[model samples]
Target: MTFLNHRHSSFLRSITQIVTGALLFVAVVSSAKAQDEKPEWKAGSAAVVITPEEPTWMAGYASRDKPAEGKFHDLYAKALVLEDLHGTRMAMITLDLIGVPRSVRENVEQRVEQEYHLAPASLLINASHTHSGPELRSRYLLVKRHDAKWAALADQYANDLEDKLVALIGTAIEKLAPANLFYSHARAGISMNRRLPTPGGVTNSPYPDGPVDQDVPVLIVESPDKELKTVVFGYACHNTVLGLYYYCGDYAGYAQEYLEAEHPGTIAMFMMGCGGDQNPYPRSTKEWAERHGRALANATEAAIIAHRTVVHGPLKSAYDYADLEFAPPASREQLEQDKESTNIYVKLHAETLLDELATSGSINTHYSYPVQVIKLGSEILMIALAGEVVVDYSLELKRRFGNTNVWVAGYSNDVFGYVPSLRVLREGGYEGGGAMLYTSLPGPFTETVEERIYEKIDELVQEVSTR
Candidate 1:
């Protein structure tokens, strides 16, 4: 009986040993699979100088400068491509220009989709809003300056930019490898509200005090070897550093230069946040531009020096487009008889809209707007909206969705014109009605613009979260 019991006990012990070995092997295999599944973040950056030899019109701040026959500060088209281990990718190309036209963006999108396999919505192209950069597609505003020569030159520059951007993205994709992403947000008070309100007047002063976005978010990219590869920063202010005709990238461009120089081989992408109503304070000089640049660079440096939360992302991206409609302007005779005829362009646009309305009886007041949201794991939510969005959208979204991580971006897909809030529409100002002259659109947006945008954003956020 004792021998039989010992044999049974030994058999049980042997079974236990075999089970333990199997568990260990499974653990090893699971760990190996996890390692294999770990996504690698690879990145690359390239810049193409776009400064013209001869002086031309600058973009923001409205002030003009004399022809620059000699060389001035150089403008650049900087491209940063980011890809995962599986080769799915996104490219952000920042241009040191006034504004990115819808046509130009579409052209670039087609090129990226054809060449880099990047989806049209995946490519984010933004302008620095530099007043010193050449005016590309503001013919509606600067009609007299839009000569055939200028148009040809602008087309050539845009075509060249597309090629350069494609090449840059391809190079970056080829240079992909493992990398780390860390994100941090800091506030800087370098910008002020450009549209200030006057006492007891519905009309805002040409120079009015308004709200501004002070938050500056920085995304630091590090190679797998732990070397700093890029520091992408965003702020909501127009880069109107120097309103001179000589080509310059303004403060945002200078900020990139400063950061890149400070950290060699490290690229910097400056994305303009919700700065439609914001303008850089103390602008209009190379020195002030450098100062602001250093301020932004310092903010980035501080974010890096301070403890930052490393973000591991299994990125999920979604893009949605909506049609936003605007009310047609009054009849041509009525518009001609209306009060605010100080700007000839506004009157002309009104006349044009009225002509269409008279012929068709009703204008097709709808515009195709794009909204894109990207979720980085369960943490970061990056929302991109088309047109020049005001600060209220960002502030409101941040307040309503404080529980979730949100980064709202404007000047994304199609930059038709200023996307004013309901409040702005009611107030009746440049952002609401006056700014419509800047586009081919009829007039002020419908009062439902705010609600339309909010609903679309909510839908996009939900889609991204669920997916």
Candidate 2:
């Protein structure tokens, strides 16, 4: 990868800002009483800065006309490894970037299983879906024009990222020691439903009254000496506050920064929830991103102070791919007509499918989507679904699970595109079907989308449960 000295004169200023923010964040909360004794759990965490080494094309928003101009803040890939007394272990890696491309996940997964001696199902990877992060794909056939230089930069960045992730997972596990784990949640109204229904149809705009997940779930990990080791938190919203030339992690970055600042030596890991159709309200400005970050941080702070559930060990984990089906492809003549469209994404989408039709004899009708389940004792059940997941999953999964702690994270493993619920698929909006034009996928998922996924979740839940 091309190297640039991004550590400019602003390094000192950035350090000062972090110190100030940490002090402020700490001042905002009263310290909790120390735990009497640590839980019988082993934990470790490690992080690496993944800011693009050089100017490159950024991901998200196809309207941008040029490569990234400069840096707002560096992005990162953080990992947490937890093990129980029974020797069961789980490793989770979180990144401050767009989706985890399938190629990247496949490479990292293979390396992790061979090196770490863990089952393929025990490792989980998530992306923050930050629009301000660097693009990791070598070529985006639909939305981006073919530029060899930009494509090379993206390939180099992706290769470097995979190496970091593989190393980070091992490093975290190597750093493992006795630790405590606790779970709790609070609310933050930073994200609103972006699909507004109108007389015309569901438009992609902020709809305040639509269903949204305001809950900020927090998981605290501390050493036996009562020192905070890591704080894992999640919210259901897209980290798209600033769509500019600079590189940053958006609101998720700010929340982690504030927490780490307030609690020195602590690693704050963010797991994105089902926020496919949600967006940060009053966005497109730095102030709003910071404000939302503060709001989310404050919510986590409140949860940290509230009554908590001690997550016990005997950790159980399961992972598998769900064969999600796409709708039937268009006829050859229809595809030819689509290839002639003025819209590049639409035309290219049709062209790609036409190519697949010629080569594979037909477009792919199903996707090998990733789905995971991890049970912490019999108390918490975590479901990590791939792609940009909508809120209906978090809402309905919780309801169906019947009051146990269910943390459903999106943008995990292989984030190929949007994963809409049956409702959203029926509504037929950007999240529903329109966004498919920007991907190599054949079409929107069929009507059985929600049912098929839930069935798999139930099976995995049974597979990982203790009692």
Reference-based lDDT, residue 203, model 2: 97
Writing each residue's lDDT as its tens digit, candidate 1 over 1-467 gives: 46668779899889999999999999999988866754457777677677865555445543343444443567877777777655667777777777777787788788878877888756877776777776565354345444466656666666776677778778777776677777788877778776766664444332435666788887778876578887778888777667655676778887888888898988788887787777776876778988898888788778777777667656667777776878865665666564257765665665566666778886667887888877666656777777788888888888876775677777775667798778767766677667777555777788878888888888878886786
| lDDT for each residue of candidate 2 in 1-467, tens digit (9 for 90 to 100) | 22535675467679899999998877655333234444679999999999988898889988888889988778999999999998778898899999899899889989988999877788889999999988877758223565788888888899989899999999998999999899899999999999999999999899999999888888888788878899999999999999989998999999998888898899998999999999998899888888999999899889988999988877888988777898988888999999999978789888888999999897889888789998887667889999999999999998988678888899999888999999999999899978988888888899988888988898898888744
Q: For candidate 2, report its TM-score.
A: 0.91
What TM-score against the true fold does each predicted structure earn?
0.84, 0.91
Against the true structure, whose TM-score is highest?
A: 2
In model 2, the Cα lDDT at residue 228 comes to 85
What would you estimate as the lDDT of candidate 2?
0.88
Clashing pairs in 1: 60-131, 195-208, 196-208, 196-209
lDDT (C-alpha, whole model) for all candidates: 0.73, 0.88
The CA root-mean-square deviation of candidate 1, after full C-alpha superposition on the true structure, stands at 7.4
